[model samples]
Target: MTATTHTRHDPAAATLLRFATAGSVDDGKSTLVGRLLHDSKSVLVDQLEAVEAASRRRGQDVPDLALLTDGLRAEREQGITIDVAYRYFATPRRRFILADTPGHVQYTRNMVTGASTADLTVVLVDARNGVVEQTRRHAAVSALLRVPRLVLAVNKMDLVGYDEAVFAAVADEFTGYARRLGTADVVAIPLSALEGDNVVAPSAHTDWYSGPTLMEHLEGVEVAAGSPDAPARFPVQYVIRPQSGAHRDYRGYAGRLASGVLRPGDTVTVLPSGQRATVAGIDVLGTPASAARATQSVTVRLAEDVDVSRGDLIAAGAAPRLTRDVTATVCHLHERPLRTGDKVLLKHTTRTVRAVVREITYRTDVDTLERRDAAGALDVNDLGRVVLRTAEPLALDDYADNRRTGAFLLIDPADGTTRSAGLVGETSAWGAP
Candidate 1:
């Protein structure tokens, strides 16, 4: 997004899992996250001591694992997550970046922000409370965001006697509902976050539940398996030209590869202008590289002089579809309502340009998954479909096809504030001319 901030993913590590944790109020999301950290020995002894002291001060008998998270003072006092808290932890096998999102319905936008880039989303649920409205709402959001993996952690199994029937019932229901939303491969695990059962280690209480613990599954899960084979798509973030050095004549397009792979001597096109060029060299952070794959950041020097600049896309194939009129699914993130005829700035890839809301098609009822008629104005956290007319053509792909090239951010032209995250088209719905 132009005015929006994207999470800075770690430089392409071979085995890293980027995941987000979400659930309804009092579902023990924070406790579960803390347990995942504490049981795995990822939390330092000092942090553990601090949590213990805080727990003792709060008149709790045991060290509250939830205290390890819930970092905000207000959150500690109220015992509710109000904002997204990110934590990084790793094991010998794999690395992890966890985004702990909020549970309140009003804070739906926060969940969207956390889960936007997650390779997997872990949605916790209380065994005492079956599938709830907010649970369904979050599952739908994960599916809508095209998060590759889905997990249901049936928490508080101790309170429910660690009964196999109880966990199975909750898991079965959630799995079915998530499948209806197009997430077919959903995994469920029973655990007690507070008592440290089946989180990082296997629980003795669940002899009947024979599945990998949350930690094992997270480490073993394939984060890149969902990506399909496609031609290389690189967006030019910056053009490099040394002014007064021996490399003064050297020019390179520096950016992260959105998809596919690139190598020296490969033919590529500079989009929005359609100039042809060959890759004379590939520079990976100042080192000469023969090839670069998707998600890797590198600079490519073309064989011939070609006009390229920020906001331009470099590709090896026919190139992404260019269009001035775009229809998209949007999640409004602010108090200011989005209405038809509102002029805004659209930020896609490295480009930001003027755009106008042509029409409001419908707003989705998250709880019911129903498309309601034009609501005139979209309130905060409302997901809807709208048509937009941009002043300039954009190179875009369907969000379902490619997350990197298909998603965009809408910005308020006046204040430069990011208003919403937009997904270009869905598998169904949205009637665009």
Candidate 2:
């Protein structure tokens, strides 16, 4: 029933676990996060005192632990979280970066932005409200974003009398739903965030629950270490050419490899131009590397001086497809509707080009997971499928196969505000396209 103590860590040897919290409003997500931090001794004394003073000002007997995460003034005033709140904490096992996302339906876009890069997502389920619509909605989003691991924290167990049957029923129902949503794994835990039971330590009240505590599960779950699932895709972010640096004449392509591995001797093809050349050398973060793995920022020198620029993609092999027409699923974030014939800017990996909405197929209802016929336009926060035609050819991969290469953003051409988050290729019934 005691919290685990952190051991001395060599910074280089520590593994970082980036996770996000999601659930319906009033599900105690922020409270659970606060409990995780407080029980783990991650919160400083000053921070805890500030929360205590704030709770006293509001005439509360217990400190509002949610105040630790709901840092915005408007959030404290309205008692609702609006934006994504990121917190960092470290344990002996791993370093954690937790993203506490808003639970309101209107702020679903914020959850998407948070969960996009998460290694794992912790979904809080109120023990009283077992598997509500919003719970299902958040689960669907996790599946759509392809988050590797999921933890179903059935919070507020004390309120439910710490009943094993209640926890079992909720976990069972969600397990079935999550499997259908295409989530690979789900770890269920029963806990009370307010009382700090089963969060950082084991809960004696729920002895029937033999599973690992919330902290135990989070620290133990396996996450892919930037492993490549598809072919190599190095989108050119900057073309480096020093006029008089090292005897001059150094043309290196600078970009982060989105997927797959790149070696010094590998043959790469510049997309849209179809120019082929061998990689002469690679510099990974200023260190000369024989090869570079996915997600590494590196500069590559090609054997032949091919005409490549910021908008071009240097891909390995013939796996990546180059096309002007893109069939993708979009989660519309803007209040202004996205209709066919709307001129927009499509931003894929480092490239942004003018594009037109070719067609609106249908919109997937997030709550019910239904593909309703699109009324030729997508409203705010509507998940829809559409086709887009860009002014230039782009090298794209199926999002289901590759998250980095298959993802894109749709921006308003007039004001340059982001309009939607797009995923290339068809999505499942859960709006994962």
lDDT of 2 by residue, 250-324 (tens): 778899988788988998899879999899999976678988888789999999978999978888865588899
TM-score of each: 0.93, 0.92
- Candidate 1 residue-wise lDDT at 112: 89
Model 1 RMSD to the real structure?
Answer: 5.8
Clashes of each: 0, 0
Model 1 clashing-pair count: 0
List the pairs of residues colliding in candidate 2.
none
How many clashing pairs does model 2 include? 0
lDDT of 1 at 431: 25
Lowest lDDT 10-residue stretch of candidate 1: 1-10
* Candidate No. with top lDDT: 1
Task: For each candidate in the order shown, give its overall lDDT on alpha carbons.
Answer: 0.85, 0.85
